[model samples]
Target chain A: MFELQAPLIARREVASGMWVLSFSAPEVAATARAGQFVNLLLRPGPLLRRPFSVYRATSGVVEVLLKPVGAGTAGLAALALGESVSLLGPLGSGFQLDQAAGSVALVSGGLGVAPMPLAARAAAALGLQVHWVHGARTAAELCSEWEGRRVHWATDDGSIGYHGSVLAAIPEGIGQVVACGPNRMLAALAARFPRAQVAIETYMGCGTGVCLGCAVPRTSGVYDRACKEGPVYQANDIRWDVLPQHLHYGLGA
Target chain B: MSGLRVGGVELRSPVLAASGTFGYGTEVPLCDRPRLGGMVSKGIFLQPRPGTPPPRIVETPSGMLNAIGLQGPGVEALIRDYCPLWAEWDFPVLVNINGESVDEYAELAARLDGVPGVSGLEINISCPNVREGGMFFGKDPAQAAAVTAAVRRSTRLPVWVKLTPAVSDLAEVARACESAGADALCAINTLVGMSFDLGTGRPRLAFGTGGLSGPAIRPIAVHLAHQAAQSVAIPVIGIGGIGGAEDALEFLYAGCQAVQIGTATFIDPNAIGKTMEALEALDWRRLVEGTRAAISSG
Candidate 1:
């Protein structure tokens, strides 16, 4: 993992408070995979670095999606075009997609959409058809910026494409499920599809396992660092009953 | 000239990675290796610990609270897995040993004794998150001395007692450890603190309370390190909220011979290296003498 100041190349508010920020981090972008994340050091804001999923990486630039639910995300959302922030990443394990045969479903909920676009692109490059299923509380909160093929939108208020949760909108024949979202949704996904890969959410520190702060409990009664051992894990391996649902983002109210 | 000795272990720089913050000294590769004086591995017990549950950490203004409860692999695993890696590294690696009893502390020291790549032991007697034995011995001078003395008798390696700022008389505990044959003293573990989640009407940390670290605790760390330095002849390795060279100087000016970088690493993985780089620009002898003069004058 490399730690360096990457200049902000682009910033866009894809949704009301949701932002897609791109930085000129060639090293991290070069090595960044589908589920890996970048830890942005938000100085003049919070004391700890906030982890963001790699929304997309192209050429020499890396992008991360942010929903301004807290002071740290708000500060990152307010960064001007020319500003540079300290970026430490390409950290944590990413989605393992090489083994899938026919098709792959990239599922996301709310800000969980951050990593879906990248996962979609990666699966497409592997000659596999990709299905992107996204959901938000309302259509206003939906970030449908992805240009991937077969994008399906789900909303809780019956104001969008599928008038139900993202899980309800998944195509019956969709293959190899990969998801990133809140604990409850992931837990449900784990129940239905035990082999699904999930990117979890946890309050993190150090983003490197050193702090042991981001403990994601396993079904074996063992805890793993969400930053190091994961951010990505097979759904069935997690002990969902013990997971706390305190975070605001991902499949909002 | 930047190299120095702390409790008999030769540190290339005066900045060491504090225990718990640096893990087993195996996780962070971005940390500048050449600039690191040494590293104190995470605190370990006799057996593997599951540590506290989720929401173990919460960020506060200018600091963060964590109650990881000294989660770590047991000593046997450390000697087998981590020590070999340390033996290959170019710096000293001190194991931060914890115990639920004085005998347990002594046994941990004995287990690490003569182990390859193990330079010394930092007795963790001030972990507030644990239910027993951690800060229990640290708060009292007699118990502090007793644990220190037992560990001293168990191992031939240098022993540094990490002090807790939660105590009423930090100096008394420092003197007691020195009298019990501590090779050095590491002043100021995290200060006990808690934060509440207004929505849930409950504490932010699952452990209810945690040890606060980062810039929020720097001033208190300098003060306590100074008090410990004044009370004991043994070296004082300053810790808590040391983010940059200026902060490390506060500890040195307060009479600390060296400093350890903790919570700052979370903000910047290269904090220790950056601090070491900044310190390299200063006169090392003057800094040491400055600390000595500061302690002697008071």
Candidate 2:
């Protein structure tokens, strides 16, 4: 909930158009959880703040992964070393993992892998066996592997591990599943598994939950704000059918 | 720093956080809640509104377009859940009221009358009047006057009518509200606008059209504030795209009694606090002497 001018500590391109940025935000790094996000203020012209999931946090530093999809993110990607950026976070409810579960699965598609690295580290700390399943259009888009963890990959063009959707690569007998990505992939995951927690992506204003702009329909017939009630929700709690068709794919980040 | 007296309430500073941007002023940590002049809460309605579906907001150059549809928890929930918290804060809290009809506006004012922790009312006439075939109350001076008069009669609290920038004659509407017993005038609300997605060949926002706010609208807002201040006898609270002390000075030089910080809060959560700091650093003595010299030279 604190706003700070965090100086860029490190910036590296992990994929073709994707990057990982680390910032020196001690307070946010200290308090941020696995599923929460940070809203980065872009250049003045585009007034809307861009929200990015917390990729990693350790010892007075926090990292966020982003792809240059539009003007807001492109502005972020263009920042130089030692530049100070305005950051408002750590925001929204992140993935809630069950401590009692013996085994867990982390499913990610496309840029959805932004939040999984931290989730993988957290699940390992909780004494649960973690499995990572990742998918993209090609092998170059797949994120680099997490050290000392079992990782599975899927590519649509048959250039990687499995020649199908990442949903097909997930093994059975997983006690719990956590996912993040485009809505269509999330919908498929929700339909296939009953015990799944998903982090949703939507258009938001004032990421602090005051504007009520980021709304997702719930199974209970009420719209819940994705900023406050969650960017993360239990799979069955969402009413996916009522969501707009354009939102089903890769539009929102 | 000197304070501002609007209607019956006295504020610590003249820079207040605008409605819909600052939330309840509870979660903002760096904002220095007690030092703020005042804060307007989010728009409240007779019943809870679900608001428009996603994409409710979109970026448009130096501004943003949003059609949040005034989503709120209704009047009863505000009284039950948030008023107790407001009562604890040292600063005054003005409730922004929105309604579907003249009667609904009056009823909402009546319900808030004499309520503890409630400092005043700022009527949001920008919403569509369901009884009038979806025409907005603020768009027409006569309808705006009627709504203001109804609320003025219903409550003893100080009333400030929030006017829209989309109207043709903003001064006419300002005068109309002043004639109907409004204590002050808050000028101006967001300009009605829209944006389209080029790739998808559709409107960027789900509602198709929305209200635009930010630095892009500042010059237009200053022009309207100047007009409204000239036309009305009541104090004018200037709003729309105020980011820093310089922007606020434009409204003050234009004759506004106070200014409200809106879209800037989205950029920095402590924008109000920062603006207050910047204002305190200014030499008022020099500014007054300069103004006097200019007037004499002319």
Clashing pairs in 1: none
Error of 2 at A107 (Å): 0.3
Candidate 2 lDDT tens digits, A12-38 = 887668899999999999999988999
lDDT of each residue in B11-71, candidate 1, tens digit only: 8889999998898887888898889999999999999999998888888878888999888
Candidate 1, residues A114-210: lDDT per residue as tens digits?
8888888889888888888999999989995974668889999978889988998888876699998878888888888898999999989999779
Winning model by DockQ: 1
Stretches of candidate 1 off by over 4 Å are A248-253, B287-298
In model 1, state the lDDT of residue B24. 85
**Residue runs of model 2 more than 4 Å from their true location after superposition:** A43-45, A244-253, B1-3, B128-135, B284-297
What DockQ would candidate 1 receive versus the native complex? 0.58
